[model samples]
Target chain A: MIDTLIWLVALPLASALATQLLPRYATAIVISTAIATSINAAALLYAVATHGVMLYQIGGWTAGLGIALRADGLSALLLMMAAIVLLASSIYASAYFNDNPLRRRFWPLWLLLWCSLNALLLSGDLFNLYVTLELLGLSAVALASLGGKTAALQAALRYLLVGLLGSMLFLAGVTLIYAGYGTLDLATLSRVVAAGPIAWSALALMTVGLLLKTALFPLHFWLPPAHGSAPAPVSAVLSALVVKATFYLVMRLWLDIFSEVVTPQAASIPGVLGAAAVLWGSWQALRAERLKLLAAYSTVAQLGYLFLFFPLLQALPAGAARDAAMGGLVILALTHGLAKSGLFLAIGIIQQRSGHDTIRDLDGTAQRLPATTFAIALSGIALIGLPPSGAFLGKWHLLAAAFSAGQWLWVVVIMIGTLLAAAYTFRVLGHAFGQQPYPRHPVTIAAEEWPALILSAFATIGLGLAGAPVWQLLKVSL
Target chain B: MLTAHWLYGLSGCLIMTFGLRAVLLNDSLLQRIIALNVMGTGVFMILITIAYRGPDAAPDPIPHALVLTGIVVAVSATALALTLIRRLTEEQDND
Candidate 1:
């Protein structure tokens, strides 16, 4: 049972390799990886349902020596999210990349991305995470460059440079941890990490690196361009998944490694950063002229919601804090994953048809692409924290926790973000609602619109299905 | 031991400051990349320094491991960025 953890990594990786071998039959690879991982996801779900948590020690070694990979309440929930999103994205990617002549070579890299994402989410060791992060970054950059336009290459290059710097910093921190503790296993590192200047310094270096990689606020100068310029599927992956992987590492380290040092001082910094990001990102999003860039900036604002957990947790009791903070973030990630992907997918269709994503130009486009319009509406509702949506549930608990903690500043930021989300969401929705008078050109809907609609449906309705299980999963008794 | 740690820390701070200045003042994107790489190297040095226990004691190999990986990743980035910059300039020139 324990050895089965490797399947989380092994299957997608094998498919990635297979895609390289049989590049022509790309859909086969996509279908197989999705199917294989879907089965694994079901198995994991069943295991978690019957048993509590699952642990796999690498190479049959014990926890302290080789490495221990454990799926607790938090890990299992995220794994489920990753599996669903991966399956949906692959389905969408099949249609998205099919007609693009430039990206005929795209499927292998996309599968590679799926492999790395799945592997990154599941890997039990720092070294393995490092390996998977590289794979994710490289594949993402290549995909970013797939647009074959000047701006796309520029964005990919910028992304490439930043990614290298980030990885270096991450590796350096990993080194410091390895030296200080003599083990890279997270569980082991947590128990052995003692309070000292060295430990604190390592934590600081590690965080600076991750914060940059995650594109959190001031360090986010690279994100808008990279996300803005990439083709839609690529943008979806970059915005929805890749950013979170780096942040996921930060969460893992903070939760397991520096759980002790989450003192009063450190609490307010991430909180302040989160609050600032929410306000600043919303303003930026509202200001942007292009739809893709607007959506890109929206990601910056959405990420701010996740960072709220840091301070909210600090202000509450242990068991309750984990309940609110972790649960909020996980649900936030899951919901935003579906919504943002759907939004990007729909925008991709709109762009393909209209041949532009510039907001000012979209006078009327509703009648022809009603499904796309509906998709945008659904995604917007989810993004805006409306009821029966995951974002709302996440936001509800987060706001409740904020009030409980008396973090009025965060509560205000949350409200402002919701308003901004509604504003921009409506702006797009409004365009799709009106009729497009035939003037310059007629738009064409591809075989692509339905996938976008399906994703949005999942995001909107899937939240309702997930509600009970999610509540129980949040019951992390520490 | 602490003195050596300070040495690495000072170097890292200097590089970071230089990077800030370079990013601020330099119009050349290439120079900015150069500065970024320099700053990254300095950070790598700092991590290795943190791994240092003493002149005689077992030097922490974790930072060494990190440096090894970081160097490879940095080189790949520099190469890729250079290619993109070249292509960008080409497109601009064509325009």
Candidate 2:
């Protein structure tokens, strides 16, 4: 089982390396990547289905001495989500960039991203996480700059600078941990670490660094430009996976190592920031003109919803807390991954057909691109927390958790976020329905439309159908 | 020697200050890369200093191993970024 787990990571990594070195067989390379990624996803799902957890040790060494790779329900679920989105993106990418010259670079970077994500999920030590985070950051910068426009390059440069500084801060924190306790592995650090000024300083440094990297409310200066302006597929991956890494690490670090550090007062900061992010990001989303910018700002908002789970998890009772609090965010992460990536892709297709993603300019796109319209409508239901989507299920559990814990302020934020979400989602939907002439630009867009609609349809409709299994599957929480 | 740790740490601190300066003030892309490399060197120095730890019990070689890996990865990324910078300049020139 452990060897199988290693193979799950190894396959994509090897494929990525092979693709980078051999650039001529672009089609075959993509096919190989798809097969490998699909197999990895299925294997993760299977691991979740049968075994409660999966573990692997590096270099055949023991846990404290060597790096360990362990996947509980949380890791497995996110890995599967990443795999599905990446596979879809790869398929969509294969067709979308057929005539573009940079298709070669696209395939390799995409594969490398897949590799980095798997490595990130599988890493068991802080040091290993840092390495994979750097890999993820570098590739994202390269891919964002792939647009070659000065705007994108400038955004990429900003992302790169911020990413490096964050990495350095993280590295310094890791060094402190190793110095303080002579171990950097999570399982060991959890057992041995004591509350002290050294550990607190390390935690503070790491918390600030990860929050900056994750683009939490005030530190989010670079995200809108980087995400809003990137190519559609690039935006999809960035939203679906990149930012999640920082949050994922924070979640893991808190649950596994920083249990003592999470004071009730300290935990509320995320809630406060989360609320601010929700209101501020939603307000911006409502006012934005470009479809992609709306979606990007919505990302900033959606990120707030994820953080709500943190404070909720702290406040709720243990048994229910694990299920409602953590489970709600897990579902939110998965659903948002599906829906946001789908939204980006759909917006991409619409942009190609209409030659723009501007709200005012999206005249008659819904009429001409009915599949894309259905895609947007379906994704909107989930986005707005309407029933029969994973977002609704997540919000339902989260609401129960909040009310049960008597956190009415959280309840208020959730309500306001829902209304704001509905407002923006329907703003696009209403625009889609309004009578306006299509733009005059001639368009070529056969390859782009299907994947976006398929992904969005799954995000909206599949959540309802798959609810029972998803609940059952995630019963084994972090 | 006891003096080695402080010496390496101080030098690392100095080089990192310059790296920070490069990242903040430099407009030239190549200069930024050079500063980034210098920053990597500072980090490498710190890693090595931490790995030393009084010369007992294999000297905590993990950070050492990570530093070597970091250097290789940094060089690879630098090569890629340089190429991108060149391509970007060419595109700008063309336009």
Candidate 3:
């Protein structure tokens, strides 16, 4: 058990370091490590599934002095989602960047980013999470600029500055928490935390910092540019994995550690911002000229669904309803992770074929590659929360919880968001099929397309068909 | 004696505000990076203040350790940001 926990993080770090030292075998090392890490992640998920929450104290020092790694049901689910998305991304990238000179440099940083993500998800300490966040931020920024275009470099710069600012605010909040409670461990802090000025200030600072990092709504200005300009694999990881990590931390802080410190008014703030994000983000997405920009805006819109659960959760009393709402939020996150990564990967193929991602120009290219179009169509269905998709199931619970709690305003918001999502998604797909029938020969990039197809299938049919296991996992705890 | 903690805390907050304002208001990328580092320094200062105990008691090592890690992170981020900024400038120059 402990070995799985250790290797889940260690394998990536080892491969990252090894890649830096022996640059020739970077691809071989990264691919093998990605496969190994995903296996370990699966093992960790299985362990958490059967045994419940697993905690490992480092160096035999429990609680106060030593760091702790924990794998609750939520962490396990996130680990699995990350593993699948990253493995697919690695495979797609191997083919996508087969001849690019920057391919070797990409491997090591990507591994480091993966390592930090696993560490952040498993971390039980607040300070340790801060370290992991910084590590993730740096590597992600480096990868974002790997394309080295003026636009990519500029976007990476902006992302870096904002990310550092966010980390600083988070650290300041941690300082206050330590001042008020004298502990930096999340589990310990949760026990001792209470509603007071210090706690409120600390929570507010941390939440705002996380919101900025998550790029929720008004703070999302930096995301579209960065995600749109990066090489597609980097964009996929950033959109699907990086932002979600911060959001996960915010959810963890609110729902688990700082639940005592939460107030109705404070919770509504995010709910309000989430609604705006849904509306504005979807509108922008509908008007986006470039397919990559559309995907980025869709990410902004999709993240709003996660936050919309907050108000409903706060309004519902402790029972099946609140649990379902929380479960819905997790399902939404997982689905978005899978679906978004697949969408970006498909877009990468389209861009490579067409030499650009403008939705208008992609018509001829898309007509040529049916597999990529199908990947987009499949993921787009999930993204739009159409019937029989995991997002549909998630939104069903969200709407149920909202209606039961008498929160009809949120229902209207979700409906509007869904309509906008459908419009924008099909707008791109509408361009894919031209009046002229292009020859339907097998795509040369079939290897790259398969992972995306597999991922979209999981996002749509796989999760949609299998709800009992996910519901069972969400039942473990907050 | 009572006012010392509040004094330190308020000053830390003020410095943070200044840094944040500078980061948001500055047009120059270099100034924003500088502002970010300053903000990090303010946070580190707050952390150090939080670690302070009574004159006789041993200060908590945890916050100190946290501050050290924060410093390392801050330095690495600064270096990366500066490098990106340099690369952008060079790309523009070549153009």
Q: Residue-wise lDDT of candidate 2 within A273-303, one digit each (tens)?
A: 9889988999899999999999889889988
Deviating ranges (above 4 Å) for candidate 3:
A438-440, B1-7, B54-56
Across residues A1-478, which tens digit of lDDT does each residue of candidate 1 receive? 6555678777777877777787777687777778788778767766766677777877788865565667655566666666776677677678777767654567778878877876776666776677677878888888888856787777787787677667656765665676567777776677778878757877877787788889888888889999998888888878888898788878877765687866767877877888888888888888888888988888898888888888887778867555766677778877888888888888888787789988877766666667777788898888888988888888988988988888788888999999998898888766666644543322344346766777777777788457667757656311
Best by lDDT: 3
Q: Candidate 2 has what TM-score?
A: 0.91
Cα error, candidate 1, residue B26 (Å) = 5.6
CAPRI-style docking class of model 2 based on DockQ: acceptable
Task: Looking at model 3, give its docking quality level.
Answer: high
Candidate 1 is scored at a TM of 0.89
The alpha-carbon deviation from the true structure for residue A126 of candidate 3, after best TM-score superposition, in angstroms, is 0.4
How would you encode candidate 3's per-residue C-alpha lDDT over A1-478 as one tens digit per residue?
Answer: 6678778888899999999999898888988998898889889878877888888888889865888888888988999999999999999999999989898889999999999999999999888888998999999999999966888898999999888888888887887887888787888888899999999999989888889999999999999999999999999999999999999999999888988778778788888899999999999999999999999999999998889888788888888878888888898899999999999999999888878889987665556888888899999999999877899989999899989989888898899999999999888888887776766574658778998888998999988889558878866653
Screening candidate 2 with a backbone cut-off below 3 angstroms (N, C-alpha, C), the clashing residue pairs are none
TM-score for each model: 0.89, 0.91, 0.98
The superposed Cα distance between candidate 3 and the true structure at residue B16, in angstroms, equals 1.6
Alpha-carbon shift of residue A211 in model 2 (angstroms): 2.2
lDDT of 1 at A472: 74
Clashing pairs in 3: none
Off by over 4 Å in 2: A436-447, A470-478, B1-45, B55-58, B78-95
**Alpha-carbon RMSD to native, per candidate:** 3.7, 3.3, 1.4
lDDT of 1 at B5: 82
